[model samples]
Structure formats: structure tokens, C-alpha cells
Target: MFWRRWCGLFLDQKRRKKSDATYKNYKHILGEFVDQLPASVRFIDQVNADVLDSHMRYLESEKAAPKTISNKMMVVSFMLKAAGVATPSKMMELPTVEEEIPEPYTREDLQALFKAMTPEERVRYTFFLDTACREKEVAHAQWADLIDGKYWVRKKTFKARGGKERQFSPKSHETRLIPLTRELMDMLNARRKSSKSQRIFPNEWGDPEGHFLRKFKAVAKEAGLNCGECETTISEGRFTKHPAEVSCLTRPVCEKHYLHRLRKTCATFWHEKHIPIRTIQSWLGHKSLETTQKYYVASAIPRIVPPPCSYSRRICSNSSTLVLLSTRSSLGAVRPEAESRVYGFQ
Candidate 1:
């Protein structure tokens, strides 16, 4: 009945090669609901809005976060729609999280952190900052992915989903090339000579590296970076050396400074160099220009405009004033054309 259709739909998603992380979450959420269903409710049609209302109450009773509750509800709604079941009336709306500007590291901060890392850690972090790559992209990268001093990130990555690992593309299924800096290129070329694993960054078992947050935070701690956000003590002032899940904890501590900050840092650097936002979006593998605009770009706009008579042309009506204005604009004077494109600034 309902159980048979659920299994069939789940298997169909797997067969069609949907994202592993997505399917895993759907399965977990759906499984919980099925288990909670009353013994009398056995048919698909029996699972209606009332049943879903009970499920919502059940999640609230368990003290689930608003975002979590919303996600679970969406998953169930999608599942029910696939099975041709009616959705609950006025279902739970998604929580509105405040949009905060991404905090990218200053050049000095980046240098200090780089200096504190070990040779291996330095190379890895340096590559991330230079390329603006996601952690999963780093995990799935192979030596063969590099060509002409650039690395190509594609769908040929092994990802963990549904309690098992399989080859798949993550995030956007689009492929992109990241150009390597000369220093980073040289460093990687040297490492490639004696590397035993096919992966660019491999675990001790010669597999794609997974969950390197502990090691990254350890390096940050040694670098004297304040990490009061991620560090939670056990009892009587005993700090946890390497917690298994750093991100799943409360308050999203990595809000200010974390590994992902490096990606944003790279984007900010490009923006500072006057690189176009569309180009930055492509390099960062963002699905839309809005994602690049909202996160990667800096919120600060410099106040460099002069008063009414600041421009040479405004002071003198002579044609030579126009030449002086052009010269001054070239020498870092306010250029309205450039400023106009930056976050709609006039």
C-alpha cells in the first residue's frame, strides 16, 4: 500500500541519480513519519492533512527548531505530492533568517593564519583561498583534474549519501575551472611528484578526505585565532580536542571566522581588484548572481567623492580642464562609472 509506494518512489529517485544528501534527508524524515502513523492508517489516502497536522505537533513536541520543522514538512509535502496525496491546509511556512554580510579575512589576517599552519595545512588553505572552492570540492578533487595550471571541478566526485558513498556531482551539477596562483601551482606540482594517492588531498587510507574541521580548527587555535565560537568544554575546564561534528552545534559559531570564510575572502579579494560580480559568481560556483551579490561582496562602500568644485571641469570652463579631469580620474580620483556597478551605489 503506502509503504510500497514510498519504497518505489525512493528507489526511483535513487535510480534517477538525485543528490545523495537530498535523498538521505528525505528518507530519514519520511521514515520517522511512517513509524509515527497510527496502526489503523495503512492506505495512502488515509494519510491526509489531519495526519500531517499530527506529525507537525509531534515535531513541535520533540522541540525541533523552526528551520528543521519547516524542512521536514517540505520533504513530506514533496513526497505526498509525488504519491498524489492532498497537502495540509496552510502548511508551515519557512522561517526567515536574517541575511548577514560575509566576513572575509583581511590580507594581514590571512597571512598570519597561513604562517601558523603546517606545510600541509598551509598548502591546502592557500589553495582554498586562492580558488574559492567548497570543502566538498576539495574532498572530491583528483590530480587528474588539473590541467594547464588550472583545476576543473566536475560531476565525477564520490559523495556520501543514503549511508553509503557513491560518485556524483555536488551543489550545482555545473563544471568550473579554477586558475591556480604561481606559488600554489608550484607547491602542488612538487607534492604531486611523491604523492601515493590519486586524490589531490587524501586521507590516511588514500581516500577523499572527509571532515577535516577538527584539524582546521586546531590550526586556527595554534595560530592564536580566537575560536570561542566552536570550542565547547566538557566539564571543569576540559576543552574538547577534536569534536566529531563542529557545524551541528548551537548558534552556528563559525558565523564570524571559519574555513568557509576563506571562500568568501577569495571573492572579496576579486571584487576589490574590480573583477566583475558575474565572473566572481562563476568562479565560486554560485547558482545565481544574487548569491554572489548577497554574500561574497563587501558591504562597505568607500566615500571618495569630492565636493561640487572637486572635478577640474567644474572649476574651469576651459577644454584643458577636461584633460585634467581625465588624468585625475585615472590617478584614482572618483570614477562614477566604476562606482555605479558596485551594489547599485551612485
Candidate 2:
């Protein structure tokens, strides 16, 4: 009976959001947790900090990354709290083992990626890759947000809790105005052609850029790039006389997977740009600065190419001064005007 009651609480938690996407995430996460529990120990008293630890251990033994298992733990903790089930007092703090830092795409890799994309997609995804804007935000961007070289995001679509949506202004957390380039602005204006409504990245269907994975795979295929399966092979850059490639999955994958990669890569790029960790904390949509710092590690591995010159160049006219610094201690922004011309060390 208590087990059934807790299950009811779980369903109630899921029902708080009616949106398919929102509910889907909650169901997949919490549902999986409950399903794996032994039936005999499914009641409220049987669930405790020790059992939670055991479940976490199960997750780790199954080869889950620390971050992933941590997320699952958070979901479980939240659920238990909502159900009035208390964690054990002695073992309340469930510590997670640290994992290796994530590898993100390099600036060179980004150049190849965007260059391979069509003009429109290049504009859209560059903003996504840079700002770490959620897919919906990228798709629904408005020209009104653009002001000078920066823009604001209105939170009309933050969530669909009920008939009403929470309306918060951009950077409501700390007032986040994402900066953009003239080219990005121009692309936004050019793309806002009249036939459709106010969507920034409308698909062929003229919807809010819905079919993301489908289009992503198509673009990847066209660009001679790979996704999950072959992403590493090409990333290794082990190509010989003939560049080796990998097979792409025919099915469209989840948007979050790609978004995670894009978001992490954006943090890495900004880290290289010498942007302050606090600034990057805002850009990456992290609530805590500690969560943000994990991704901005300094790598010592040297690239074959020499650093760009310390002068602003017209190579990518849209790009501002190319900033390249060697060490964390020595920090400055170089215009790199002539940096494009020098590739001796690079």
C-alpha cells in the first residue's frame, strides 16, 4: 500500500508539467530509477540514504559517468523530498567520485564545422555554439533582442507549467545580454524574411525549427562530418593521404546530446579567449560558478601551428580582434589583424 502511495506521488510529480517534452524527461529519469528497485524494498521505510547509495553504486558499476550518475541522484533526491521520505541522517551526503574533464571541439574544428554548414545554418549554429543558447532559444530568437552588438532573451517560453508561462526578461538571473557579431546580426535580419512568423531559425515546414536532429544529420552528411559514432575518429585527425571517415547513424539522435557538446565546446572556446570564469558562468546557463569552472580547464598540449599574430586582421571580417594568450597568468586580447597571415608555427 505504501509502495503504491509513493508511486502515486511519483506520477503526481510528473503530472505537474503537461508539456510532452518536459514530462518526457521527468518520466525517463525517475521512472527508470523506480523500475530497477527490488519490489520488496519499494515502500517508503525501505527507501533511505543507504539504499540510495546502493542505487548510485549500481549506476556507477554500470559505467555511468560521474556527472550522469550525479544527475540521476539529484532526480532521486528531489523525488524523495517531494514524497516526504527523508534521507538517512548519518549518510545524508552522497559524495560522487570525480571523473576526467570532458574534451571539446577546438577552434580549428569549429572553423571546419561552420565552414561546412550552409550560410543560414552557419549563422544559427554559430550563435548556438557560442552562447550555449538552448535549442528553442536559438530557433525562436527575435531581432528585437539585438541591440548594438548584444541582445536580450525574453523568457516567454521558459516553461509551460499551466495555461500561463513564466515571463522573465533575459539575464533575469543576473541580467544576461549575449553579445553577437555584425555578421550574426546581419544573418538574423536577413533570415527574418516575411513569408513566416517571428521564428529566427524556421525549417522548411515553417515551424519553430522543430526537426533539429534530422537537419543536423543531413548537414553532417553534407559536410563529411560525423556524429556520436564517428565523431572521435575524425576528431583524432589521423587522416593520411586519404582522410578516413566513419559511418553516420541513419536515425536522428537526441538534441540534448548535441547541445551538451555545443555548450561544453562554447565554454572551452571562451576559456581560450581568456574570458573570465564568472562571465562564462553566465553564458553557459550554470546556476553555480563551481559547475561552470569544471569545464574551463587550461590545457598544455601544444598545437603545431604558431599562435595568431597580435594584430587585428580582415580574415573573418565578422570576427573581432583574435585573442590568443599562452598561459593562464599572462592574459590579454590581441587584435590579430596580421595573425591570419602568419601560420609558420601553426
Candidate 3:
């Protein structure tokens, strides 16, 4: 069969079990790839190493990001493999993209975002920042998941290895229990009193698959946490202004203050409170301790100042004053009794 025909068949097979969004993404990326191919190449077998290498060059010339190129390549690789074709051995030499470290949201940033949110937004946003659930996990949460002031995040939808779609409980098929703070509990109680849908945080249409990021960014833009401003322009006799793009802030705001950052922020908050790395790993639903330690945990050392000790002047020389250099422990705080004994002037 021709590569295009095979692609259409693969897409149809995927659409039967996968989501429209996933299907659309694969189709779009594959379509773009096909556009860059030579018109004479009709069969899947005709697409060789040289064609792929040329396509990579084309993608690079178009200024596609390294990550984007890698994703597109994954689609191509999958399609080729599915059609009983082997990838070129030399095609393994793709661009090495560095993983960017996730930056957590600051307490001040969360506070600002909270202040700008509506009551409904506040309840949902606070849940994300507190629970550290991924966007999809939070979207799938139901009132039934709330048990004894804790939420059990059971995975509802997942994309398995090889881009196969399935409905299951979380990424690791594990249910995570996240303790609810008093604030979160209050929000839940309030929501439960008025909510009609089974899902705790649902869209206006009461769909379980809610678009949380849209609301999150809306609140973020209003809070001035973002760096750009929306300027209205009349194009083709239509006036339009994207409020999300409109910003007056002079300083560059970190664009990483999205929903995922809230998850990182939750992890960071726990790390700051002296929570063990392993404990944090389970709470954040991380598969590896390395993942928890390397990405989620922040490197902030707490700065706790010890209280000044009052000493008798009679014990020391009359003209000489004792200088006690303020020191901190690994735990960041020194006990009041320990402080006096260590720095006593004699």
C-alpha cells in the first residue's frame, strides 16, 4: 500500500480507540511530514534514510524546536514500524535535546494568582497547588474520591507505551492518596454543597474532561504574573484583543507558572517543610526517587535566625565585647538553651 494509504489506515485504527485530540495531533504531524516528501515517492518502502535525513533538515530550516522535531520523528518511526518497515540504522542520530528543569511557583506567585481568581477558580486552583495532581488527574477527580479529608487520585485515562490509549487508574496504575489541607477541605465542602456534577472540578457543561489550563492562564494573566499585554488590532475590519497576551509588566515573568508548576510548587512546599524525599515521591506519584529528587524538590536552604542571648558582662573583660557570629544549623534553627551555652561569654 502507499504510505499515505497506510497512514490513513493507522489513523483510523487509532481513532477507534484513541482520543480525537491524540488522533488530530498525529494526523497533523504526519500530514506535515508527507508535505515535505517528494511527489514521486508513492510507497512506504520508498521512504528511505536519505528521505528522512532530508526531512529532518527541512524541519530544522523551518525552525522547529528540537523537542518538536523529536515528536514528529516518533510519529514517523511508529508509522514506518507499523507498516513492516525498519527504520534506517543511521537515522538514530537525531538532535540531543536537553531537558529543562521545572521551576516551582513561589508562594508569592500563588498568593497573587489566588487573589486574582474567582471563587470557583480559587477552589480548583488551590486544589492543584495543594494536591500536586497532574492536570488530567485533577480533571478526573470526583466527589467520591474525597474520603476522610483526603483525595484519592485514580487514573481515568492514560496513553500507554507505543501511544496506545486506555482507561486506567493513573500513569503507574497506582492510586495516590493526597491529604487535604483545611483550606482545600473548606473548598471541597463548599463545592459539594452546590455541585451537580460527579466530577469535583468540571466545565460549565459538566464534562469530566475540563479545560483547567484555560481558566488557570486567565487567572494568571489577570494577576499580572505573566509578562505580556494584549493590544487590540483591527484586521479585516474586525477589532480583537487577546486579554491573555495583554500585559504591562516591565520585568520578565517566568512563563513556567502553569498548572504543572503548581505540582512542582506542591512538591517544593513539602520539601521546604522537611518532608522525606521518599514520602514526597509517593505523594507526587513519581515512579522513581531520582525523578522526585532531581526535578520536583527545590534546592532552597531555609534561613532561620537564632535569637540573641543575653550574657552577664561581669564574666567578660570590661573593655572587650564578645562578638557572637550568628550561625545556623542544618535544620536552620537553634534551640534557645543551646544558643546560650554555645555562645556564652566567659
Per-prediction TM-score, please? 0.69, 0.64, 0.74
lDDT of 1 by residue, 1-346 (tens): 6665775676477545665556777778888888888888887778766777788889889888777877788777777767766554345445444555568775445545665666788678767777878888888888998987678888874534334556747479789886665556666898899998888899887766775665675666565665455644333325655444443133223435566777877676566545567777777898988989976546342323433212111111122121112212232322211121111101
Clashes of 3: 7
Please provide, for model 3 over 83-185, each residue's C-alpha lDDT reduced to its tens digit, 9 standing for 90 to 100: 8786543454577887665687654565567666766776787788778888878877889889876788885654433666666357666788876655567
Candidate 2 per-residue lDDT, tens place, 128-220, comes to 764667665676565566665565655545332344443333333444566553345455666666436545665665445666545665665
lDDT of each: 0.63, 0.55, 0.66
Best by TM-score: 3
Q: After superposition, how far is residue 262 of candidate 3 from its true place, in Å?
A: 0.7
Lowest-scoring 10 consecutive residues by lDDT in candidate 1?
Answer: 337-346
Q: Give me the runs in candidate 1 sitting further than 4 Å from their true place.
A: 4-24, 38-41, 60-63, 86-92, 98-101, 157-165, 227-257, 299-346
* Superposition error at 220 for model 1 (Å): 2.5
Q: Is candidate 1 or candidate 3 better by TM-score?
A: 3
Q: How close is candidate 1 to the true structure, as a TM-score?
A: 0.69
Residue 39 C-alpha lDDT in model 1: 85
